[model samples]
Target chain A: MASGDREESKCCFKEWMTTQEEDLSELFQALTVEPENIDQLKQLAEKSITHFQDYIKRRNKLAHKDISAYFAPNWCSPWENSLLWVAGCRPSLFFRLVYALSGSEVESNLTEFLLGTKEGYLGEVMSSTQLLMINALQSKTISEEERLTMKLAALQEDIADQPIAMIAKGLSKVGEMNGEVEKVLDNHGRQMVKVLEEADGLRMNTLKELVKILSPLQAVDFLVASKKLHLCVHNWGRQRDQKLGRKEIDEEC
Target chain B: MASGDREESKCCFKEWMTTQEEDLSELFQALTVEPENIDQLKQLAEKSITHFQDYIKRRNKLAHKDISAYFAPNWCSPWENSLLWVAGCRPSLFFRLVYALSGSEVESNLTEFLLGTKEGYLGEVMSSTQLLMINALQSKTISEEERLTMKLAALQEDIADQPIAMIAKGLSKVGEMNGEVEKVLDNHGRQMVKVLEEADGLRMNTLKELVKILSPLQAVDFLVASKKLHLCVHNWGRQRDQKLGRKEIDEEC
Candidate 1:
């Protein structure tokens, strides 16, 4: 509960983030298609995201002077370790599949600076102009097809295979229901939104990718949840005896 | 989404609970448990307990008007099957165990009625004063040796084998330090001295139980939190030394 201890713990998260930027080392470095192998990489991405969330939660609690909130034996889980796993590994995997991979020195160095490598406090890897310059170069180099392909590939291959990913999705779905529920939980705040948006987007993208594989029932479920298409949901339990079916209706209907 | 649907679903809980109590039928009339077959009893007990917890959680959620809270496509969950399992098999197990060990009611009628053998309704089983009164009499008649030696023996055997239980204990131990922090979270609500007294008793009980297996250091960690013996609890690291070597120091020391 000491302010000194809180300051010390804050250093841990600050240093971790510094390290991740320096090490963007190989974003997309870890995506795979095989079901079993995908789990580990997917887990690493989740861990990275969770670490960021934990960092944010800790930052807020500390800022609010709830410094006595002891987190897991008072362990301030390092946020950068989480990000690094996904940052370089996941982005690199996408580049490998789509665009000729671009691993920027700014991305890597900034990550390391934020996450703090072996050096207790490493050198500044990139300046403000340097970061802006790198962003400009990346913007010029990237194309829409490349972006969409990598994004969809990551969603289908890496994100969906994770168990924690589903929890992230479930939390998101709850948000889609109402913000009051999320606020009442108070246990997890904005992290719920981040996870939900990611899940919602990923679900849409993946379903679109696998539209050919979906049965009529599965399609109905997706459409119902996505569009809040009430009638399709009702039909889930009563599709039988609709033998008078096959007549096409208006698209909205 | 529908207010009427929400109320009706919850009404299902209270309404279903208010059915007629059914007497034990032929299914349980010839029930028996082999003494060495502890595994079967443990499985049945755990299954029933898991189901019971889900039922309680579901009922509470519905009571809070969130009937669809736990809905998944999952049809074979404990929530769906627990009452039937408890009413049908586990209740029989409990009856046999009680009867054989304590000379309590081995009759199927009361067991069936209590377990919902006739009908699976929470209100009926819980509201029946006559059945409760009979069970209370039977429970009181059970000797300490019968309950402790038989019932506790079953629990110990199961608790020993449960990996999750061990992990939960470890997590609880690690989380204990945070309990003090939680108390500090509410300044007006925190009656520190009162908490310290209760913590002392709980610590003493926990310490006595762990004395046989825990290292001296582990025991100290446990007792320290249970008793809220820390001033700041700012840090608890480097458990290099396993022995605390305490010997009732004088107040001056």
Candidate 2:
């Protein structure tokens, strides 16, 4: 902690991101192979999910010590940081992506596809039962999100009620701001870590459930969309940061 | 902001850290060369400083958007995060490293070197005037640190007085938690960024000034020590985190 330890963690996460990019490319290649190998496609889908699980596990371990870091990670652009829900994307984002993808496909091929003219595209992507399940999952995720938000609110209040209040009082008393203030802050940090853990758990479970509901080919497509969206957001955010003068333009060169 | 932008920034920093490692090894090689090449050493020293300055510039740009990210950077271990002073190591740390290095040298070679028994051991490393300059720099750094700490303390108080208080009140108002809460938090975030910018500026200035005071050889040696110490701390911290179960041991494997 005293030295470059954080640098090591940063390096580890960077490598993970690189791996994600490579995985995304592999998934894309799998999708385009003309023969349409179901077994290979399914294996790739499961492997992608496993890789994601590994990342979550690694992050969870890091979160235990410094959850606040994840909540406001420096590794992310300020724009991205502003949008973070409990240290990462909201679990409900999965449903939103799914809905958006489905809606767009239907809209583009509306006349032909809905009239039973397009057989493979519509039915193969999602069944009515799958749609219903997704709807339920969305509701469940939202409620869970609300519950976590409330817990976060309580912790935010405690920041004022506990450590901030103690520090304020100690300042007035002319010096004696050591052990007690630290203890309160430490206690707060522990609670914050717990909230983050719960949030991450919710995110992982939601992704797992959604993947389960997806057909193997559908899962691969969804995963591709998710990865692409994530990367796009990151790039877009960086551009925005540059435009806003929050980031240096010359660094890119 | 929404997706993987943080991942990009993390990767950038990880690359920077890797560059530092390579720079450190080159410096060590420079140090060990026989009949030391003063001009080459000076160039290397200056080059290292320039590289560091570039990093600071990049970080400063990022800080404009989300200063809190730097203050609680996720890239670092929680142990390292706990020790951070305004987004990084204290400016005074440079002085401490110098003193530790000098003191250790003096201690190890006391009898032979101090009694005019050894020629190139102590005098070539740190001149009397350089020590005085460093002492003065240390004092100035401490006062500046105190000032920044006070500013940070005020900002912490504002979290309770402004945003937290507003959120608490909004929660009770039945459904009015919209623009005002967001505005208050945004204002607070801006202030936080300014404080981070000022702190980072201080760190960069202190380092530049210290380098200005040292001889080329001394500066190179100091830079090597600093980089070595940083890398060592990072490794040590990771080990400690693993032992504490705050980090995954299997990740290394």
Q: Name the candidate that leads on DockQ.
A: 2
Question: What DockQ values do the models have?
Answer: 0.02, 0.02
lDDT per residue as tens, model 2, A1-253: 6223344445556666677778877877787663178787788878887887888788777766555556655456654554466777877767766765566556545756557564123234588999999899889987898798657645643432323432432242222335664466567778878888898889888988998888877777777767765664455445545544443311310
Q: Work out the TM-score per prediction.
A: 0.17, 0.49
**Which tens-of-lDDT digit does each residue in B82-162 have in candidate 2?**
445666677766776676556655654575565756422223467788889989998998789768865764564343242
Summarize candidate 1's per-residue lDDT along B93-180 as a digit string, tens digits: 2222222222212233357667867311112222244345436543533332233223322321221122212222223222222333
Lowest-sum lDDT 10-residue window in model 2 chain B? B168-177
User: lDDT, candidate 2, residue B243?
Assistant: 46
lDDT for predicted candidate 1 compared with the true structure: 0.27
Evaluated at residue A177, the lDDT of candidate 2 is: 36
Instruction: Say which candidate scores most in TM-score.
Output: 2
